[model samples]
Target: MFFKEVVASLYAWDLLDENVDHALDVLQRETRTNSTYLVALMHDEKRPLTDFYYPHNPRRKVYWTEDSRAYWRPSPDGYERIKPRLSDSDELAGTDWMQVLIDASRARGMSVGAELSHTWIDKERTRTELADCVQRDVYGNPFDGQVCFNNPDVRAYAKALYVDLAANYDIDYVMTCVRGFNPGRGEGADTELGRLVGTTHGGCFCDSCQARAEAHGVDWAALTERLRWLADGYDRFNHKQNFELRLLLASTANITSLLVELPELYAFLKFRADSLTEFFAEVRTAVKDVSPRTDLRLNHYAGHPELMGLDLRSVAKQLDSIRSSDYAEQSGDPARMEWKRGYLHNIRRTVGLDMYFLSAVSPRPKATPELVEQGVRISAECGADALTIGHYDGSWLDCLRAVKSGLDKVGIEIRPDLPMWQRAAPALDGNPPHEIVPSSRS
Candidate 1:
């Protein structure tokens, strides 16, 4: 009985097919979910063609939105203070995608939500206008993706972006999708040994970050020196003979040793976490100040939140809900079953907020139907308030059916919101009645 909602995260391109009403109907019937969160901002560059499951028409080119642009237009009051450095989507500009989704969702009596990726900014525009906002290494070299959370302009822009969404739309919720720092990207080495040896790119030592470090009592100079030494050592190790063998020999002892040798890493990590929690608190207040009814959520994909500087327990207090793919046992390892089982329960009990574990329904190396059902059972068992499937478009019918079956097994019944007449169109010859394919425009 802990489950209060079932939300499907749908891509914008999924609705491009002409049969907007029919698409929503199909989504409801298949996923048996009462709500949806439309991805309106940007897309993943690494998404392959196979990731798209929207059965396309013959004439339509199989393409996805590659730009880091907001799909909807900002209002007059929005972005008046700071520039988010955002660009308009060439393919979907003037389409009013968010409003279109809200209207369609209203017809089906379904709630609508939106998510904004923290790092998905227009790099070209940002490079010109707000270059200091971008994350930087100890050497002050800027990372391509993430903007520094410590930067004042970036923080202001984040608040403005969420406020804009809440003020402009009839949305139910707004989630911040953050991919914090990639602590495992050891400059160019990228290995577990690199992380253990503390050679990873734990950065944002830009002027803002350095100032924040000084204010927070973190010795920025000492931390930077340690990071440089580690980077040099890693480089030297790579050039040495039998480097792979040396890497494999490294262990967690190296982590402990590194922590002992360089204790400033602790303060730096805490500062990173505190910075994010502060950002979330500010954005939460900003959104609530503008539109009190709109709920805020955090969707962070990385595991080991401590390492990534995301203190989930503290951050959870600022969110109405949280969606995490980590600790889901998505890897399907039976040995880690208890870890997955306790994840949601612990968070809910401790933080006293809704927790939504993202259950991916994609192909292999992602998730299968059995795993999806098990994930549902686990979420229900853990007292999670919601379950959000990664996407309706990327998912198959079998996985969606498994969700319903799992829910039924747990005494949860999901009835379609659409009326009988408007429930679903007749299925194709070989497909089931609930199965829906897109209509032609030309």
Candidate 2:
């Protein structure tokens, strides 16, 4: 029942170079410090960085060239071409990073896991397959290229991919990311457009979503009209005099009235949550079907479970663990440790204590070694089952070393070669103890 105390997220491109042996050596050395699990990004559909490991299913045919470029080619006989996204370099052309990591992890006595992203597709490469899966906003415009969870085709594709990873790779666990609805703007509401687009719309009124809603006894047409009226009001106010004030007032009134008057809005939210739960359940079944022993974990946004359609309490039985990113750099006013504690409290409340909880921390460019230590210490104090750094690259060696020092301070064992300080500082006494404040949703 022992899981990794520390895990590292590594990008495949970083390991696809000629000096892979050196990179693996560094990884082995660092992981030995705390018996870290190396979770490598095996397939990234959002960015298409690595090659596809699974054989192409003719029914779900998608093709990519040797240089990691994705394309589509169909024949008149209902057939399609398929190829691997192999590296151009001779040293890495035939190399299989998954196998490489498996061998290396076994040799080093460390655990290895595969990280994959679901509900993401390359727009240019798989536009035909993703046409019906794209999420539509209140204005009937697509939200980038994120796939809708209600789309049966997208769900099937995701399930098949998960099965391939589980059945093929000899991994300890399978971790997935971005398995929820899009939460609006990416730049943190810094821009007016970001706020206008992100806050006003819930998302995904596509045909599949509408069909599912109707099946759930929700009045899809009426809901669609109300959303359109809201969108129209915003558009009208955006162009008139006193635009900012008018738009703000209209948006506030619309959202308030919609929530107060419309029962269908709540129903729609429930539908979305249910849809995601079902999708995840199917995925969990698929993974178990392929390899019953491999663990299944989900990486979700820490705050705003409602926006992401994540009803953790409902899906807890299907998952072995849940992970959330703790971006200490973005902790505005609170100390990084305090912010981490609040996040952990939220996750614990949502998922309860039955499942293993992990905290993934991202070190900012300006982060000092001391800050890194505080982040790790706070995660341990908050009762995190495991702690993982956001990524492993040349820039994060210092942060990794700082994490090791922090783990050592808390009496966690490390490699003998990386020795802890012989004389530790004495614990202070007679000082008022720190009180952890409970996190509030409101």
Top-lDDT structure, candidate number: 1
> Against the true structure, what is each candidate's TM-score?
0.80, 0.74
Query: Per-model C-alpha lDDT, please?
Result: 0.62, 0.56
Tell me how far the alpha carbon of residue 49 in candidate 2 is from the true structure, in angstroms, after superposition.
14
lDDT of 1: 0.62
Query: How many clashing residue pairs appear in each of the predictions shown?
Result: 0, 0
Q: Which stretches of candidate 2 lie over 4 Å from their true place?
A: 1-3, 18-21, 28-93, 126-129, 185-202, 237-258, 329-334, 414-442
Best model per TM-score: 1
List pairs with backbone clashes in candidate 1: none
Worst 10 residues of 2 by lDDT: 432-441
